[model samples]
Target: MGPSRIIAVRHGESEANLAYRRAGERPLVYGRGDDEVTLTALGREQAAALGRLLAALPAGEEPEQVWCSPYRRALDTWEGARAAWGAGPLPLTVDDRLRDQEQGAFARLNPAAVRERFPGEPARREAEGAYAFRPPGGESLADVVVRLRAFVRHLERRADGRRVLIVAHDSVVLGLRHVIAGAPDAELAAVLEFAPVLNASVSVWRTGEGAFELVRFNDVGHLTS
Candidate 1:
């Protein structure tokens, strides 16, 4: 029996997100480690807005346990949300498995940079497809699913019948969708193309009739509202 409800959140926009956006025609290079990236001002606001939404949930629906990634951006996002929550701290656990997808040798390199650095990688990735394409020393989306599968099993064991909140990265959110929905590998590409996970988006899953159903996917109503 897994948790009755699971609320999965992607960390708000980070400096890296901004850099990637501004890297038009150039290779975007992040100065620090991925785990060290921090949230932008707008990201903080988005997180606070998310917090307000979570805080407003009915008592019975409120999260009982919180899980987060150890990455700085994720932690900071949670802090901002918790402040806006104003309901005092919840039981929080930081887990590395919730961290973003590792790019390995391709870390901090944009498409152009990757091509320039490793001329053959782009062709290789194209051949392998996005889901199965594993970067050198990094993880593929399939690899992410492997770890997320274990995490979901752990959640089911420890959080049976409870409502839980998870604050993590975009990859984690997508991975959770794949794991919880029991979707096939072929469907992931469609989901990626049709349903891009936005930063600070909220996704909810609820258990019903012995199975988990998606209540929402990539919801940004809190920010828009």
Candidate 2:
């Protein structure tokens, strides 16, 4: 009766996740020779667990369609969940809009490296909720929100009465949260300050009249059990 419910799920933990470096900051090497840098064993477990959680949802609340980022890590997560929902044959659209924000020179760097490279301004911005601070050749939190706004608007208009599952990255998840919460740009940055979106966490949204409400945020109901 309204815009379809959006269940935004983050991709499983990645190799960079365990490596103490943020993959988004690293160069684009996936689909070339980056399989080893995909998901970690724990990430695989987390994805399977998420699948079970999704499978357990009531049929009425289950997703009727699925969308995923083109990244191999995201696709790997979706594949891990295939069995839990019996979500066979349903086309999973790949939307680059859902890709993670580029981390610039910080992609494969640790905190120390980030600090060394960026110095006072970078650290200060990271600490003080600087959503608009764009790094060299990368995106800022504000940039991510802008992209997510378009995606949400499209979904709000194109979908109705069904649940849509979005398998995406942390930047997308964080942006979606800010969009649904109607947070001011300043506040949105505060929310992400050092709080990385965990693997396979879910954020739920309901939209109407060009607006959205965050029904749930960072929901790890599957992991609690």
Candidate 3:
């Protein structure tokens, strides 16, 4: 049996997110690696909001276990949420597999920079589509799916019948959707193009008769309310 419920949350907005937003067409370079980027002030507030929302859940629906990415932003977000929850500690594990999709040489480069740097990558990415396009030395969405599949199997083995919470990146959320729904490449690509996941958003899945069903996707009502 799998987990009775799975709640996945994307990390709060990070310095990188803000940098990219403000960079416009210029090449935005990070002084630190992606894993080291911390959340912005607003991101911390968003995380605290998530914590409060979780604390308000019915007793039966509360999370039993927590899995989080090891990245700094994710760790900080979890810390912020946990502090706001003010509840007894839940078992928390930092898993490298939950880390964001690796962008390789294209890590912080905008499309224009990527085009200027690699020259051929844009055309190649376009040709391969979102699912199959592996950045210079990075993993493709398909690669992310491979690792996430392993993680899901691990969850089934370790967290059966429990409520589990996962704090991870947008790519991990997307990968989980693909893995759980058994979605095709085209469908996943469509989602990538049309429905980008938001910072600190919550997605939920429930299991019944050994099948996982999506209850919500990219829900940020908690942040607004």
Candidate 4:
């Protein structure tokens, strides 16, 4: 049986975001790898806010199963959010499938810097088409969708109508959306262009009529405060 509900949340603002904002004129040197990036102070608050929001949900809607990315930022969010969720066993499990997409040469380069440092990448990415384009050693957007699809299948098998929550990265959010949207591989690349992933936002999906339907995308009402 499929999960009754699935909530995908992006990790809150991270140190990378802060550094980017601070690097006004300088070429923001690579600070840390994607997996190593940690959430900022406000990010911790955002995670706590999410926890309260979830706690306020109807009991049945409260997440009974939590799937989180193994990355530090995502894990930190879960650690903070789970506190407001409940007192007993958290039922939280980390899955590598939900981790951020691997980055090769693009590991920590700013977008603008990418063109200056890796001149061939842009043309090659454009030539191959965004969906199928893989960086020097990283996976493509389509690759992420494939792994997310596998995670969905795993969810179908394990969720069994339970309310489920997924805390992960921006790419994972888009990846999950691409998988659920059931778009053709050709269209997968445009998913990000059309659906912007929001940090600390919750995207809710429900499955009942033999397919998943997105009931809400990027809901961040809790962060208003």
> What TM value does model 1 have?
0.96
- Using lDDT as the measure, name the better of candidate 1 and candidate 2: 1
Writing each residue's lDDT as its tens digit, candidate 2 over 142-164 gives: 88898888887776665666678
Error of 1 at 22 (Å): 0.9
| Cα error, candidate 4, residue 217 (Å) | 0.6
Q: How far is candidate 3 from the true structure (C-alpha RMSD, Å)?
A: 1.5
Q: Which candidate do you rate higher for lDDT, 2 or 4?
A: 4
Show where candidate 1 strays beyond 4 Å.
185-188
Spell out the clash pairs found in candidate 4: none
The residue-by-residue lDDT of candidate 1 on 1-225, one tens digit each, is 989999999999999888888886697777878999999999999999999999889878899999999999999999999999987768898988898899999898777778888999988989988888999999998888889988999998889999999999888898899889888876766556635688899999999989999999999989988
TM-score of each: 0.96, 0.82, 0.95, 0.92
Q: Which residue pairs clash within candidate 1?
A: none
Q: Which 10 consecutive positions of candidate 4 have the poorest summed lDDT?
A: 21-30
What digit string (tens of lDDT, one per residue) describes model 4 on residues 1-225? 678899999998889878877776566666788888899999999999998898888867888889999889999998888886654666787999998877677878776677778888889888988768888899887888888999989988988888899999888998888888777776776776745677799999988578889998888888996
Give residue 11's error in model 3 in angstroms. 0.3
Give me the candidate number with maximum TM-score. 1
Residue pairs with colliding backbones in model 3 are none
Backbone N/Cα/C clashes per model = 0, 2, 0, 0
**1 or 4, greater by lDDT:** 1
